[model samples]
Target: MINKMQILSLTALGNLDAYIRYANSWPMLSAEEEKLLAERLYYNGDLDAAKTLILSHLRFVIHISRNYSGYGLPQADLIQEGNIGLMKSIRRFNPEVGVRLVSFAVHWIKSEIHEYVLRNWRIVKVATTKSQRKLFFNLRKTKQRLGWFNENELRIVAQELGVCSEDVREMECRMSAQDISFNPFPDDESSDRKLTTVMTHLRDNTSDFANGVEEDNWEMHATNKLTNALRILDKRSRHIIRARWLNENNKITLQEIANGYGISAERVRQLEKNAMKKLRTAIEA
Candidate 1:
């Protein structure tokens, strides 16, 4: 009996508990009534029958969404995703198979929610393989007391989940490791006050000094090679190469060089190519 407008109003104004109660209150259909609706929607392609089926199931999506609230995702978004899954199930549902719509929709609803959790939980996904993904969820339930799992417990969980003990340990480590802010500043620090942030930790004085010395040596070696390569070029070719690549600003075009030397643009390009080849050969030697 609920219209689209009424459903929209209820969704907008009602709290989570109110929605739960409203959905639960929808009368459970008798076998005869369900069969009739399923036949109409499935065989006859009756959209009105489909709409009724979906509205009746909206409450079920809300119920499943409640279970996932512990994941730190917004409840509204989870409900929306679950609703999408419910719709998909409705479209693919086979009423001739004799299963109730609620039973069929459960898998679809949970699949959509699981995908959302994996994608949003961390920037880098913690679970890649099938066993790791299973452990990622199951291991949370297996924990008896917080802290870390003991060796025996780890082995037991590995046996139960049919994964290696090492995988369980790795997943546990990943789960326990919280994301740290890249540039965390002290809470009490004022806007004008300059406090050392995480960036400060990136610099180790000894490593930095060594890196600087190595970089300087690399630049000096590169400069020597470049200077030696330039020496191998004829004057005009060297000038063309420098103008095309080495100049900081106001680089001359091939046409400008050609005009200056009273030569064609193609001739200038050929000279530049020859110069580059000679430089490369000298550098390699």
Candidate 2:
């Protein structure tokens, strides 16, 4: 019993030597046991039955999560997301679907993990349209190697993936592209890579360049002063200032801020007073 209990413990998996041993120790449910548990939860809303179903299939979640390892996301976070999908599947699952829970849960598990990967896999989103998103996941599997696909290969991938060749090429370009710093340092020698960074040289082509420069300079000075002023204030006061003044959308009210921090509105007002005074003084200087 002690050996079995030790085998089930996930702690052993943290060590490379014992990782396979722990994975091998995971429990598998027989066909009868799986059906019984699913039925118990489906009929009685039995929480224990749900727990057993989830625990017994955790290895499946791990397996599905590993398939997405190419996305460069943390393995633990992928597993966590898959667990959420598994729970959602368990909640909505009907035993009458004529498939085992594992079969039904695979879609949900992969769906959740896929969403997580798509969201965090790149600094800027790679895909917005449905077809682009689908290609984003499947295109890598179609390719044979690390290098870019030729025109012929792109056509073949597009056909297999049911997208236009242009789409495969576009997504391929996106995947090949790497995230760059938005504000690259002035000392960087590579101008091409530096230009890839956003907003550092962003200019409104329609706007006057000279006045734009003047306005931009003023804004930068004002922002720096405001930031310095905010630093002098405490954490709560800084948050109150940003929530009240800095935030353009969904600006918070004194009462709302007070409610959040468990203080009276009048106390919040006093803090706002001191913060604004400091800002005005700093900005004037």
Candidate 3:
């Protein structure tokens, strides 16, 4: 359940400078105060405690959101997404855990911001693969300066990112490309100047019956392969993977699943990792 105070914060986000100032005005909670509030929320499901925790952490969200300003997205929207992540982290926080809330919340905060950047960065979506996504963010900072990379610089970047040079080159090209409208309006003088709109030469491929049938067959084949792969796993590993990842609306934490099975959270994590490895091998086969 989301706190009402966060909903109020969303309204103030329209004026970003004022929102930042408002967020900074909230006092930071001391270690004892934070732990007590976390315990209340975690153990008792206290919504008031949740509200307090979120209000205090608003400034931290702003600080993290500022780091992604290069993506050309609005600052207010980034803060709003980071706020959602903060709320999610609070919901799952365990006071018994040794780490501080700020330390634990950083991962959730950055994760939400990363998703926002990728979704809005381009119309065509630049980075789909895992390696390409890593390259997309780091490539800009790793480059020496403006302009395209030479061969030596490309090799250096690939080594840094643990990807082949070709991957880095491809990501660089994708990042440099700009989005164009499929059908653009012509200028007032176009007829005399012989200027033509893009729609004039555009071809529609949606009516190709063979291509549509092929796509449907591929999707059905992938789904069947995944079902078969899951069937091969041990019961416990299969449940862990489904609970943690497959249930998108409500993903269970490792600690929660561990408590049910009488094991440590670390053990649950290990099982999840191994299960994913096996599933990948099966699917690829």
Candidate 4:
């Protein structure tokens, strides 16, 4: 156990094997040695004491990092995170506490690694709430089979984790869901199988070429019917129909049309009713 931070000669972890070898080369600190270092750092703020403590405990960080390899994240990154947690514990460790540095550092080390796994395990975060987050970390280990859980398995897992079955099921579904690309690559060999892309086939209701053509054809056919129907009416009736119904911006009212035709407004209204009935019949036919 060690309880101090030291700036090691290690600059980067680009060469993972070399970094691991270097980290493991440091021997573990004995109990007396750790106590002396902790006292020196705590009382006198001795930087050298901190250095020795951190160097001697580098292997512990490595040992703890190996457990998180199941998350599919890079091992070097996990080791780096665990190393941070170890340093954090060293900063807060008190020699008077009577606990081994390794024992005290374990929680901090696992905490950093857990955060890393949650962040990088999936593109979308699988865990949000505290219960879901707890279930997420423990659920993977509880699961024995490869596929989804049966009711028995789900209930067992929920009971073991002390959570509701619904939470377990939700976390399981989240874990099993795959993140997909929004726009698939055209050159990809498997693009055909992954046809679930927005760019490929999402319906654009605002710009439907087939729908636009159909609508235009229907409008033209209706216009031709109305024009033929108007030709069947007398000239006065056609004028009255156009003024009353077809003119969009300046629709002539019944009284206005009546004034233009030198007839009562009621006469114009009767003519409009008769003309609309005829147009409806002709269009239907």
- Name the top TM-score candidate: 3
Task: List model 3 lDDT by residue over 56-135, tens digit each.
Answer: 99899999988898888988888888888888898888999878898999989988888888999999999877667777
What are the TM-scores, per candidate, against the unseen true structure? Answer: 0.61, 0.60, 0.66, 0.62
Query: Distance (Å) between predicted and true CA of 268, model 1?
Result: 40
Using lDDT as the measure, which candidate wins?
3
Query: Which segments of model 1 are wrong by more than 4 Å?
Result: 1-13, 144-147, 186-190, 195-285
TM-score of 1: 0.61
lDDT of 3 at 23: 79
Model 3 Cα shift for residue 163 (angstroms) = 0.5
* Segments in model 4 whose C-alpha atoms lie over 4 Å from true places: 1-11, 145-147, 186-285
Q: Global lDDT of each model?
A: 0.81, 0.78, 0.86, 0.82
Mind giving the per-residue lDDT tens digits that candidate 4 earns over 1-285? 332223323524348788777777888888998999999988888878877777788788888888778888888788778888888888888999998899999989988888888889988999977777788878887774535689988888888889899988888899989987776557576656643466566677788798889999999998999889888888888898898789899997889888888999999999989998988998899
Which regions in candidate 2 have their CA more than 4 angstroms from the true location? 1-24, 186-198, 206-285
How would you order the candidates by lDDT, starting with the best?
3, 4, 1, 2
Residue 197 lDDT in candidate 4: 65
Instruction: Compare candidates 3 and 4 on lDDT and give the better one.
Output: 3
Error at 225, model 2, angstroms: 44
